[model samples]
Target chain A: MGQNYLASLSHYVPELLACLTMFGLILIEATYKEEEKGRGFFFLSAYLGLGSVMTFSFFSLSKPAVTIFTNSLVIDPFSSIMKVIMVLGTLLAVYITSQSKDIEGNLKPEFVIMATGVLVGGMLLSSANNMLVLFIGIETLSILSYVLASLRKGDDRSSEAGLKYSLYGGISSGIMLFGMSHIFGVLGTINFTEMAAALKGVETAQLAILMPSFLLFLVGLGYKIACVPFHMWAPDVYEGSPLPVTAFFSIVPKVAGLAALIRISHNFFAVEGALNIGWVGVLSIIGALTMTVGNVSAIGQRSVKRMLAYSSISHAGMMLMGVLVISELGTRSVIFYSLTYLFMTMAAFMVVSFVNDKYGNDHFERFNGLIFRYPLMSIALAVVMFSLAGIPPFSGFVAKFHIFTALLTKKYYVLAIIAGLNSVVALYYYLKIVRLMVLKDAESKDTIGGFNILNQSVVVALTVPVVLLGVFWEKLLLMADGAKIFIQ
Target chain B: MISLSSYLFISFTLFIAGIAVMIARKNIIAMMLGIELILNSAALNFAAYSRFVNNNLEGHLMSLFIIVIAAAEAAVGLAIVIRFFQIKETIHIDDAAQLQS
Candidate 1:
């Protein structure tokens, strides 16, 4: 028994280390004098701690999938890959925040702690095997995000954003819990595997209750991912939060929410004719609607941040196409798209954050004559924007290509068509930004300025992956393919 | 003894009321109360289901967890409400539309 306990503890070493590091940060913040803490110490320590945790988790690749804590959490390739993505995402976010002028001085430690808290929650979410664990993981992530969204004290917009996010979050999760009560009542089990097993014997009449329950459950997941009809809070939250937090919201939770959705879908919805509630049809309609709403709404936005928020929503819709297929290829494409998306979205947000830092806002007009002044940054932004528009020779195109191919392979022709049209609509807005940056003459030539080395490096670091992944995507595709083993 | 269906009906009523309150109320604190009502209804459903459907204790345990999570959510929600009030001097959500496009 003691040896078994030790073995279980060993399985969680990475998470334990991350938690300890977070506690250490809190302690250092509490104990140290404001003058003695220095400028970069918190961020540096956060980067080291998160980076080390991410690097260490890579070793779990060689280990077999294990269910610890009485099957509440499963450590597998899928969870490990997602954990890496989330940790790396947080690490980059920390680096970006460190470089940004928006969050300074006393707020730095709190930012690190809250972001790390979200990362830990995301990590747990990816590994969750039971509903109870999933609930805790999501709450931990959501609560911290609510706080992070409001971190800019004295900013009315930031506080309002936090309030809106929490209000939506609370209502959705409450509804989801009500749905969970029904699911538990029907199956008498919270474990996904057990729920799947029980679902095989469910009667058609029972599906009446089950179908609505599942739809209600989707509400919580949909809110986290910010799909249409459930995405009202996203633009407000994204536009109001600090840039790094907005960037964090764009990537980490979406990925983690998708991870959780994929896990739940695989366990409950994947079996043929086992529990026919017409989920694919439902998901397809949701996918089409999400992309259309996101693209159309994005077009009229003047604020660059709000436009990107809608763009991210549309991207989530495209990724949903991959999820709808429910096959190995589908999951593989989704994972690949998510990985590529990380770089492109981060690069775009990094540029936005830098511009926001410099000009004190993220207005499209602010980008005029950018190429004439900051040529390198403009070129980087142009590349990132083209990639986002799904143009060829960039990572975004490859990601979208995988998703469309997955839909075609599954004979989801209508969805493919809808997605294709949405891409066109998306291109117009994306290019509008590019045109402003490249062709529109600056109101004044001296407005744009060169970026600092750290900011430039971050942009370059994110851009190289977008370019390289377009050319050398096979390796990452292979890794994504490998990650699908856990789902199967 | 009360049947499971009656408990479910009562809980469903509470859930609908909660959602209605959430939609109709402009005050942030009232919205939070609506959320709490919804959560309590879920907890009630879980407890009822645990007694009627399952022979084990998982449903009861889940309700307990939900209660704890709801408490945490309320704490955060109240804190955000206070912050919003500080910034805008009113708890009406309509007054806090500074970030809208």
Candidate 2:
């Protein structure tokens, strides 16, 4: 009775505090003047961000780290690392909302609600030791995201994006849930560690259940990350949602979902349960297809968001390689890669926001003669594009190198070769964005003239992280190493 | 009081009906009802599965939470769909293709 009470208390406190703050922000926004909403949004995000950091710091780790929640909600170094990334990434994404005029009228507070909801989900997911908790956490994030994607209810494109996205999301969830049932039946446990232990002695009956369940889980995760074979909704959704929502969607959810993927794969599939060497072929084939299809589809895209959507799918492919490594090095590589990728992806989308606002169009050619027009934004766009293309001295390149080295160490020779070659293929499309911004002719001077303070601040804040992470990435790499030990 | 097979069969029947609703309905509200049906079937399954397999109440409790969550989802999803329909009229999803705002 006491334990159940404590569990309920432990579960509800954080969730309640988070939800109350979100509601309070909505109420506060009602009294807020138009000019005050931006600052209100910023302060709310800051409060939430600091609170999350404190929770992560106090609950999970001492100097070496604290304790956990019943040892089920793991407050380990690995979770700490992902939690920090999620909190910081979400903080920036929230601020991006304040700067953009994407949320019209009183609907702006909904962004706060949805974004905070996503953060809560991500945080819980990173800490989930029980499959039950993990499912709820993941579903919470997905449900909120589907709403956020289509929240621009006034926009037809937004509705389409929402419906397509929700349909796809619902199906994935169903498949995954079905798989979870099989897994639960086979292992007879909901706790991940216990499940892992049970998996060891189980016979073929369990394998039949385990393998399909694992596949279903991965399929659902794949949709969130927008990897190929399950990436169809991304282009339309990204293109249709408000720019800030797109930016938030691309980075924050991917990081959290991938973190869950890492935990699940490392805990269940990497060693104990059916993780024979043969699984390598499965990972390799999926990874190769994700990259190839993403790059190929992106090549013909005209819309910036559509292209970035495809681009993120390709990056998901790259992220999958780290999971395939399933080693401590691979875990570290994924963590490091995500940290860098967050900044670079944010920087790319910030530029997208600018172009969308200034010209009211996100078509690739809409950026004609951007270099002469908005010189600062042009440079940022080029840097993000080049970084995304894996060019040198950029964070994306550094992270890509880390993954390549990790894969090479694992001696997954084909995956290593495919990843390296795919990076080259990726260059063509990322360069296309850069080329449009830098070398192409400006159709009009309309986009370059105005520079709002909010826009300038967001662009600068996002850009600094990308370049700095690229230039001096070793310390971050060391942190990834720390987290890796926990995952492995 | 029911046999496990009958319970399973009933739940499966309900699940199939939900799938049919999901496939057959063009009305957004009806589709949501279909989702509720599907969730109800899952809840029934959980109770049945637990009775036959584990003899625990955890499954029953999870199904309860699942039903609660499905209610929340239906409320939110239908609101969004209704708002969308107001603007577009004729909530036939095929007509709403201006998806690049």
Candidate 3:
């Protein structure tokens, strides 16, 4: 009984932390006053943030990760770095929530609870060595996100968005689980590294199952990344979700989900150019389509929220550029780029949320004279926009440069050219939003006016990195290169 | 003893039944139930293949994991469904087509 209890306790700490924090939050919600609920929520989010930081540090420096959970999960430098990303993104999101007068006024603790659950799940996913654990992590994140997405209750559109998320998520998980079963049937193993070796020994005729299995796995993962053909659910969900939650949805999950995708492909399916050119080709094509479609579709949307939704889709495509190569350099590029993307995205959405709060709307016309009125906020949004558009002196340009260099090193010249051209095309649309805020002036005045402190901090927080990346990128570049060593 | 084909056949029927219900059911609850059925069938496959193959711990452990995830999904999914019904007061998916283009 002692041994059994120890085993469960060791492996389940993160999940248990998730459960405890959630329980504490529920208790707090009932006992705390309405105006003070956001404070309690922030405290809970900070607790999870501390838990993540500790786990990451332990995974990096100690042998604790090695002995945890009977070796079901591995905690390594890669997982540690990704954990920090998840933690930062989640903490900022909770901060954004805590500061919102709208949300805190009648707040529910479930917001904090769900955010922590998603963060814990994402951190676990980064280091999931077993396929089953991967599924668990993914579903936990998705389940919590579904609630977060629909949290602005009593709105018909919001509920509809939640329903869409469930159906898409449910189907994707079902497919992924089926694929796992097939993989077990073929290789007789669920561990990713072991399964790779087992599948290698199978005869050519027998490996036919490999294609279907991989296809299903890709679809399951693809939905999370919001790649084209699987991105049917993103726009509605983004538009309907409350602003901070949408911001969280757009940035954090993509990082963890794609990190898992890269892990599966790297660990389970060894990249042999001689054998797996097909997977590379499939990924490259999808990457190309995702970027082009996301960029083009974004241009046509009148609603700023919906436009950002499409922009997020395209960024997924941009991130996949690194995944197609799947080298140490590629992985490092992905990590660095995702880190850069996270802050820039948060910054951009911070401005958007602030604007939405002040103007009481999300239409493009309302954004006119935004720069004239809210200079600091507009500048922050511009910084993110320029960075996203791959303008120099910003980290987005540096991130894309690393990917292009990696692809070139891999001799993927055509893909390199396509990404380059796409960035140029992407520039136009991102600039359109920038244009509305500066080039055109608003026809009508906003009722609730003035720069809110929370948004001011959000913009300041967001702008620091983009400008720093533009100036002192080499420091992070070196760290990225060092991290690349572990990815292989 | 159940033959390998019979076990596979049972899995197939469950999979097919889930697909049918997902396509035909009008109520969101019924559709989600179909999804649960499909996930169970898939989990059974993990167990079945594990038994038939090398009788190793990998397959069984995987099946256990699948069961855990399926339950998590169901709980959250049901919660969402309840939340949706509270707003719309209807369970039929067709009536909830605000997002269809």
Candidate 4:
């Protein structure tokens, strides 16, 4: 038994290293004096730690799937790819925080520490294979995120964001637990493998209980991914929190939730049954509704940050469509979409963070005539917006194209139509920013202190993938195809 | 002797009451209590089901973890609530409406 545990530990190296990195960050933060502003050593250690984590997960991507920690957790290519994306998102958010003046200088290190903690939770969530681990992972992600949302101490808006997030989060998780308890009672197991095995033989009476229980389970995850009905906290939390926190929230938690959701959908619902039909039906309705509501709500938003929040909800809806199809093709497309979304969201948020730092607000008018001042940054934002709106010649378009293919394969034509229309609606708001940057006159000729050469280069570097992937996406599609969800 | 159905009925009542508290209560702390009620009801359900049906250890283990996690969640939730109170000088849930569009 001890030897078996050792073997499992060997496969768990990446998560262990990520935990160590978070601890190292805390120790480093402690050693810094109160008056110190730029803790260069702290950031250097953070970069090294996260870089090592990303490298380890990347190497593990091609290895065979292994269920570690006594079958409670999985280390698979699909999860490895997700961890890579989440860590990269965290790394980029940290870099954005380091450059932007949005977060107080003193509080910046705390952001790094909390973000690393959240990343750990995300990693756990993406790989969880058992009910207990999944519950723990979700709680870890939620608790740390509450602190991150209210990082601006004494700020009313920030505290309120944290409050709303925690309240809604608590209620949803509790409801999910109720659902899970009933499932455990009926299935006689919490391990997903055993549960799936048990599901094969359930009677109609069991099916009735299982269906609602699974929906309850979905409430927690859907809340994390910000789907409709469970998405009330998203726009408020996104707009109220600091920009870097918002960026992290959009990428890490959403991807982790989607990864878990895909795994669950693939595991238990892939087989034909009333359960499968019911689950897919519910997912389809939620997907279509989430897309329409998010897009329509975004059209009327004046705050650029809030608009981005709505747009992200719509993007999640699109990803949900991929999950509902319950095929390898659907899973692969979802993975590819998330990878593209990481770059587009990061680049867009970086620009917005700089703008918010300068004007103290992120309204549409703040971006007036940005091209004249910093054309590189302006062009990068435009590319990202176009990509986000699913225009051609961007990775966003390719990602959406793959999703459409997955939908058509399943004959979910109505969903495909809804998603296509949402993209067009998205274009109007996305292009509005572009128009403001290009056509409108500058409000002031003053330089934005946040857009230094280093920052501009980073923004441009991130945008490169958004444009390059649109044309040369076949290679990535091939890679995603290899990242099959390992079903035992 | 207490039956399984009786436990389920009690838990169901608690669940409904928790939801009612959350929906009807205007106080933030009251809402937090509602969340606690919901979590406890689930924990009770797990323990009941474990004792009555499965006879396995997983349900007991789940309930234990639920207890530990609920405390942690409450700690964070309360901290955020304290922060909200400090800023707004009120614990009314309506005061949290600043982010509403």
Candidate 5:
């Protein structure tokens, strides 16, 4: 009995550590004086402690896949790496928030606490093996995100963003639950492994219900990842939320959502001749539409945040292409792409948040002639932009190249072509930001000032990875490859 | 005795009604009610399926969980709606379009 208890505890070490840190932070916040400056130190310690625990867990828990806690959660290499990524991403986001002008004073601690809560949900999501666990994880993540979106308190836009996010999230999750009911009716089980086993002999008549079940399931996951048809809420939400929350919304949930999708797809759809649901065809079409819509609409956005929102949608589409292939190589590419994407996206949004804080707005005009005043920041932003555009000698290019090569390897030639074309369209808007910053002169010199050392340091720190990952991607790719054994 | 299809038909009607209300309603609270309807329909389906098809308690358990989740969602949704109403003095979603591109 003691051995069993110990094993379960070890299985959830990282999540337990995060939960403890969150409670500790709450206690500290409760005790601190209203005007205390030491709160920042506590927040920093909480993030560092959480990050270190996740990193430690990632290296130490390298055992083969095992189902614990009555098989509701699975601990494996894939989830381990994804959990580490989510934790590190949360740390980066908290750092950016600490530097943002939007969230100030006592709100900072609340923000960190809520962000940590979301990270816990994400961790749950990446490892969930049961439908109930998955649903709970998604809702936990969604509820926290709604609160985070409206964290700007007095801002009308932020409140509206929160409302819209909740409405959309509520409806989609409802639909997903309905789908789950049908799936449960058909399979009589919620455990993924058992469901996969039962699905092997499903009749053709059952396929009718199963197909819609699959699509309905996609609705929830698609909304989380902000893919098309379900992506309408993304731009408004991203535009309205505090910058760090927007950054968090873009990367962490999307990665976790993709992880859930991978789990579902591997268990249900990857079994050839068991259930021929044609999910690949549907996902491929969605991928095509998602990228097209994302890139096309991005061209007209005046707000840089909204443009990044659309770009993220397009990137989701590209990642979907990786998912469609359903091979070890394809999975590795998606994982690797997500890792590289973490750095590029955080760097870009960090620059945006800094610009917004300094200039008071995130419009393209504010970015104009930015290179003249803050040379270091501008260069960092330039590197980030070039990488985001998937230019050579940068991480984004390598990520995209991996995705495209994966598609081609699967003989998804048409998807590869659509993705290739979308890259060109994506390049135009990314470079437009670069042009505004570098080529065009600032319309007014009044806004010129030296870069904030803290902001500049953060931007530089994030950009280094974007460049380093591009040059030495093999290390990350090797790690990603290690995470590909999902179906065993 | 009622058949499985009858329960499914009722659940389907509930689901459709929920979707229609969600699409048609302009008031955020009303839309939230629509979401509740959708979730309850799903819960009903789970209960019915467990009783009639699976012959097990899993679906009933799922419905119970769904109830809890729907309550939590409603709580958060209503809070956001209240916050929005306080800010704009109106509950219509159309007026909250200040962030549009």
Candidate 6:
């Protein structure tokens, strides 16, 4: 038994390293004097730790999938790739936090600490193989996030954001647990493999009970991903939270939730049954509504940050389409979408964070005539916006092409058409910023202090991938295609 | 007199009452209680199902974890609520309308 446990531990290295980093950061923070700013060593070690975690996950991409900790958690190529994306997102968010003036100096370390903790949770969630691990993972991701959302301590808006997040998180997770308990009772197991095997022989009456329960299960995850019904908290939270925290929220949790959603759909509903039809039908409606609502809502927003929040909701809808397809191609496309999304979102948020810092608000008017002042940064923002709108010659287009290919392969024409229309709507709003940047008159000649040499280079570096990935996406798609879900 | 159905009925009632409380209550503290009620209902269901139907430790374990996580969740929820109260001087849900755009 001990030897078997040792074997499992070997597959658990990346997660353990992440946990170590979180604790190490906490301890390291204590040694600093109370008034010290720019905890230089703290951030350096954080980058190194997250970089190593990403390295470990990248190396594990080729290893055969395995169930560790007694079938509670999985270590598979798909999960490993998700981990790499999440760690990169965290690393970049930490960098943004280090540079952005929106968060006070004293609170910056706490941001990294909470972010690392959240990263650990995201890691667990992407690889969860059973209900228990999944619940634990979601809770860990959520509880810390509530704190992160309100990291601005005394600000009423930040406090309100945290309150709303916890209230919503608490309710949805409760509903999810209720559903999971019923599932455990009906299926006689919490392990996904055992549950899937049991699902093969369930009675229609059991199916009746299971259907509602599965919807309840989706509440928690849908809340995490900020889908249509559960997305009410997202805009408020994203707008109210500090910019770096908002950037973190947009990437890590969403990707982790999508990864988990993909795994769950592939595992339980992949086989043909009445349940399959019901699940697909429900997801299709949800995906389409999510896209429409997100895009339509975004068009009316005045704040760029809030608009980006809605845009992310729509993006989540697109990824949900990939999930409902439940094929290798669909999974591959979602992985690629998330990878490109990470860079596009980081670049956009970096620019917005800087602009918000300089002007104290990120309204649409703030980006006016940005091209006249900082041509490189303005062009980068424009490229990212175009990429986000899914225009060709950008990675977003390539990613969307893959999803469309997967959707058409499965002959989901209705969803395909709706998605195409949503892209058109998305383009209008995305181009609003681009238009303001390039065509509108300058509001002020005051240089944005956040656009120093180092930050400018970093923003440009992030945007480089956004433009290059559109042209050279074949290599990344090959990497993403290797991320196959392993069903036991 | 006591069977699985009775236990399920009670837990389901708790679940509904919890949702009702969440929807009906205006006080932040009361709403948190509602959340607790929902969590406890699920935990009770797990325990009862473990005893009456599945006859395994998994349900029992799930219930225990639920209890623990619920406490942790409540702790964080109340902390945020306290912070909100500190800022706005009110725990009313209606007052958190600053980001309504």
Cα DockQ of the candidate 3 complex: 0.69
How closely does chain A match the true chain A in each prediction, as TM-score?
Answer: 0.96, 0.90, 0.91, 0.98, 0.95, 0.98
In terms of lDDT, which candidate is strongest? Answer: 6
- Worst ten in a row by lDDT for model 1 chain B: B92-101
Pairs in steric clash, model 5: none
Docking class of 2: acceptable
lDDT over C-alpha atoms for residue B8 of model 2: 68
Give the range where candidate 4 chain A is weakest over 10 consecutive residues by summed lDDT: A479-488
Whole-model lDDT per candidate: 0.86, 0.74, 0.77, 0.92, 0.86, 0.93
How does model 6 score on DockQ?
A: 0.90
Give the per-prediction TM-score of chain B. Answer: 0.95, 0.87, 0.94, 0.98, 0.96, 0.97
* TM-score, model 6, chain B versus true chain B: 0.97
Candidate 1 on A316-341: residue-level lDDT in tens? Answer: 99988888888777887887788888
Compose the digit string of candidate 2's lDDT tens values, residues A191-271: 788887887887886677577667876777777778777887888888878888888887878887788888887777676
* lDDT (Cα, 0-100) at B66 in candidate 3: 71
The candidates' interface RMSDs, in order, read 0.7, 2.8, 1.4, 0.7, 0.7, 0.6
Give per-residue CA lDDT, model 4, range A41-95, as digits (tens).
Answer: 9999999999999999998988889888788998889899899999999999999
Q: What CA RMSD would candidate 1 show?
A: 1.8
Worst 10 residues of 1 chain A by lDDT: A479-488
lDDT of 2 at A65: 33
Clashing pairs in 6: none
Cα TM-score of candidate 1: 0.96
Off by over 4 Å in 5: A1-6, A274-277, A443-450, A479-487
Ranking by lDDT: 6, 4, 1, 5, 3, 2
Q: Candidate 3: which stretches are off by over 4 Å?
A: A1-23, A34-67, A101-104, A273-275, A444-450, A482-485
